[model samples]
Target: MTEEIIIAGFGGQGVLSMGKILAYSGVMQNKEVSWMPSYGPEMRGGTANVTVILSDERISSPILNSFDTAIILNQQSLDKFEKAVKPGGLLIYDPNGITKLPSRKDINIYSIAAADEAGKLGLSKIFNMIVLGGFLKLKPLVQPEFIHKGLEKSLPARHHKLIPDNEKAIEIGKGLIQAVQVLN
Candidate 1:
């Protein structure tokens, strides 16, 4: 099974971290993985994105024009990668700052109000974990234990104490995601 995903959003939104966690979890699951991140020099509020590829067999390259899934966290990303998802693939996004919704019937679309929820719940730091949780609920790509280990592996030791909170965010995210009507 090969899953090519692009997670895109503004910088400081943990887009890269989410991709890294997925990459690490795929490694723990003994899957071939590749992670590539891109962002403007003026990070923070600038746009940021990461591409993560997981597969059972050897991956040919990290570059990709299309993806099996696209995790969009902002309006800009939605505008950019909405067409990048392969037909019958998945497109998950947070509808906070999005002025326009996705209008594709060929792919399955899901929305998770992660950013708003995180702000309300005071889980802003783990917002990406919540998003990750939503994706896992829909895809179940990697094992749970591997995700825990991935959290431990990706997050620095000093931040390890917050794992439980992150886990909780994930659980919340799982329940928050909802299917949107596929449009033309």
Candidate 2:
């Protein structure tokens, strides 16, 4: 199986980190994986994105013009990558700061209130984890054990104390994701 995913958001929103963790999870599962991230020099508030590929066979390249899934965290990203999802693919977004919703009829669309939920949970740093959870709900590509290990591997040892909170955030995200639109 090959899954090509694009995650886009502001730099400080953990967009690249989420992709990294997912790539690590794929590695732990013995799948061939590639992760490529892009961002502007502004860093914090500037747009950031990552492209990740997981497959059972060798990957040809990291560059991609389309994706199987697009996880968008802001309105800008939604506007940018909404049409980039392959037909019949998945488009998941957090509706925060989004003035317009997706309008594609060919792809499946879902929404996750990760930012708001993270605020309510008092663990705002794990916002991306919540988003990751929502993605896992739609696509169970990686095993849970590997995900746990991914967290351990991607996160620093000093901040490992928050793994449980991140895990909880993921659970919250899974429960919060709602289907906005699904192709028949």
Candidate 3:
């Protein structure tokens, strides 16, 4: 089956990068994928969004009227896209950012405190990677190893050293989900 995921946040939160990494993982797994980014005039400080589609078969279109999954990194994003997810779709949000919980019972919503985890790692920028980790853990759409390798390849050669740290961020994100699952 194909999955369409949207990642959104204010600029500089790595919203686009999060979608790219997930799409790259799909490529590594031999899936057809597309990464489409939405940018506003202000670019960095403005609202940013990305749509990532991964399919076992050829992907027809890059535009997603609705999504099978969504990761919201800010309150505005959550309010804007939370209703766009398909019925019974999955939605993941950063608890640090979202002030209101989703009211739809048909959609599965997860509130993860990824910013706190990234802060503990001394890197607030890695919050996006943490959200990606939760996506992998809960959805099983792509392998973590594949995602890590894709991230390494997608980064600039000059910044290759950051791959290991990114992988660590992903791990911590997965750990958070696992901990919550255990609690439940």
Top lDDT: which candidate number?
1
Local error of candidate 3 at 171, Å? Answer: 1.1
| The best candidate in terms of TM-score | 1
The parts of candidate 3 lying over 4 Å away from their true place are 178-184
- Candidate 1 matches the true fold with a TM-score of 0.96
Better of 1 and 3 by lDDT: 1
Per-model TM-score on C-alpha atoms: 0.96, 0.95, 0.91
- Per-residue CA lDDT of model 2 for 1-184, tens digit only, reads 9999999988889999999999999999999999988855855678899999999999988999999999999888999999999999999999999988899998999999999988987889889999999999889999889988999999999989988887888888889999996344
Backbone clashes under 3 angstroms, per model: 0, 0, 0
Each candidate's lDDT (Cα)? 0.94, 0.91, 0.82
Better structure of 2 and 3 per TM-score: 2
Worst 10 residues of 2 by lDDT: 37-46
Candidate 1 segments exceeding 4 Å error: 39-44
How do the residues 1-184 of candidate 3 rate in per-residue lDDT, one tens digit apiece?
A: 9999898888998888888888888899889999989865856688899999999998988987899998888888888998999998888888785566666777887777888888886878788888888888888888877987788768888988888888888877887753212122
lDDT of 1 by residue, 1-184 (tens): 9999999999989999999999999999999999988855945678899999999999987989999999999898999999999999999999999999999999999999999999999999999999999999999999889999999999999999998998899899999999999654
> 1 or 3: which has the higher TM-score?
1
Give lDDT: candidate 3, residue 121: 68
Better-scoring candidate (lDDT), 1 or 2: 1
